[model samples]
Target: MLFRNVISILLIFGTPSLVLGCGFPPDLWCSSPEISEKCGVEKQCSLWHSKQALTDVPLVRYELYYESLCPGCKQLILTQLYPAWLKVQSIVNVTLVPYGNAQENKYGGKWNFTCQHGPAECVGNLVETCILSILPFDKAFPFIHCLETYNPSTDGKYCASLYNLLSYWPSIEECSTGPNGNSLEHDMAVKTNALNPPHQYVPWVVLNGVHNEEIQSQAESDSLALICNAYQGVKPAGCTKTGFIRSPVKKIL
Candidate 1:
């Protein structure tokens, strides 16, 4: 009788329908015959579909912490970062935190920021924060590139219009001018301040959550090489085109 009861309990608990929660090691939690029907059909976990299953390429994590209106930041974004992204975006997971060397204060439930440049920079940072929030990374990047290429302070709406993102402008403007912008910028500030080893200047480049002077110099000088070199396994065509990877010599057997 005890053996029968134990078998019954095992059968009940072992059924895939009884499983709860989905996570990594997707084969087990997502798509194994034991779990696939319930977990895969319901969860539709994008990570497995979009990234992991596609190529199994490990993407390099690159985070740039900078403030609007900083000359070095502008140059890096305009010349190095954006161009490199155009090439290696598929191989790099990029995050831009636009709050560098900024101080924040709260008064009466209202948050105010003091940026490194001035009031214009504060507004510019808020605008960028709103841009990033409103659009997907692919759509937001060009708009940001446009703003930095010309004038972040004045070219916001113009850039949106140029990108046919005019419909989103009203929302972006409202975000920049409202409490949402404050919250977003506050999140950025928190992330920036929490960086290990801390950031000492604008345009601080962090790779895989690590920061150092050598990374800083390399990222500033040749971001493409920096990212390509960091990535492992099945490099994208961009790496070869950019001369970062050489085709291995085949042994003539």
Candidate 2:
């Protein structure tokens, strides 16, 4: 008999809804503010207190490095991990780092990595980070909702659609050419090597200045668990089957 560990957290109103799908069943979590309509008063009050305690803690900066084309990155973001981050919004400074040059190359109109996709990249990262940075817990829901419904694809129109969805607009020519032309490519290669030190994979996530390789391995569940553990301080027990273990967050930090 295989025993799966399912952690269920009931988030009361006023709490950011993170951890929607990582390891907890979606049915077990509720976002509605009316406690009477969603959960018992006792559970609601308890969750409220927990949320307060969580919010009082100092925020930790976390960077997630991923490729736009990687399915594992998509899974981790759209699934429970991202939701969990939402729950702890007051305590997390989340940064989305687009790792690797492939997707940017494939979409941003420049094959060689030239131009200042830096502003675009920085914009996207800062938007998410800013919401998590300044918005009240209850107000950040729409961003997460939009991210959940995002379509992950690299086809010209598909990528463009997502960019627009994020309110990220590239020039018509830039859209056709890609994010980083030859110039950005040269800069990225140099920067990635300086930062990531050249690994053999893609989708590496840096959490609190720690880079976990699970993303590169396409270990979606494992990466999610590792991310959860990093933020929640609870070791994930069921992710070994998915190929993740307790390792350094990379040597860069």
Candidate 3:
């Protein structure tokens, strides 16, 4: 299955609403206070995005569901996702869901998970997800890519101090190591299981809630081309220069 990093927002009178878009759901998302706190900032977040981020504006909601230590996942994220983000960050909202295709298991009062790369990958998954929960996308992403670039061969807390993410360790350490961490990962598993047409592997890619098939093969090579073609507004000079045909994405009815 494919995991989605969906967030929820709390209402004025305490009613809750499901929120799915880029950025932390909303401040004070009461459904899960501790989890929500990790995604919150000192200032309250607005349910409404800035004018540039409104629906009318052409936007590509890039959804990447991948394991933290998978080779293909790492390649696409560092080469495809990050670079494409730099080019079109003004017009896109990239959401990363690090759970990928793994399932969680429980036994003997302990929670466990398996990753394509082995036990170490599972540990890396928790660390990455924990980072995202606290840091904004821009900060969290660079840390992820940097660690991958510096030591793709090894994955885990080794680079936490290297990136100074350890400064936020107090905030995330609880979320990544205990039952709290288990619950957070559980949320990801739930979202992954809910994909309308479940995915077949890691690094599943989607744009505007639809699957992008061409990405499986060309992500590292031509992701910007895909996003540029899919964009539905005043074409940036970059997009026009390519004159690329719109690549259709598979929409779920």
TM for every model, in the order presented, reads 0.74, 0.40, 0.65
Over 16-43, each residue of candidate 2 has an lDDT whose tens digit, in order, gives 3434223434333333435323434335
RMSD of each: 12.2, 15.0, 16.0
Better of 2 and 3 by lDDT: 3
TM-score winner between 1 and 2, please give it. 1
lDDT, candidate 3, equals: 0.62
lDDT of 3 by residue, 31-94 (tens): 3545444544212223322222344675777777777667677777766677777767767788
Name the better of 1 and 3 by TM-score.
1
Clashing pairs in 1: none
Q: Which stretches of candidate 3 lie over 4 Å from their true place?
A: 1-55, 108-110, 151-164, 218-220, 236-253
Per-candidate clashes come to 0, 29, 2
What C-alpha root-mean-square deviation, in Å, does candidate 1 show against the real structure?
A: 12.2
Quick one: best TM-score, which candidate?
A: 1
Local error of candidate 1 at residue 232 (angstroms): 0.3
Best by lDDT: 1
Instruction: Report the candidate with higher lDDT, 1 versus 2.
Output: 1
Runs in model 2 lying further than 4 Å from the true structure: 1-58, 101-111, 114-191, 212-219, 222-253
Question: Per-residue alpha-carbon lDDT of model 1 for 93-208, expressed as tens digits?
Answer: 88999889889999887789998788999888998999999999999989999988887778899999899999999999999989999999999999999999988788888998
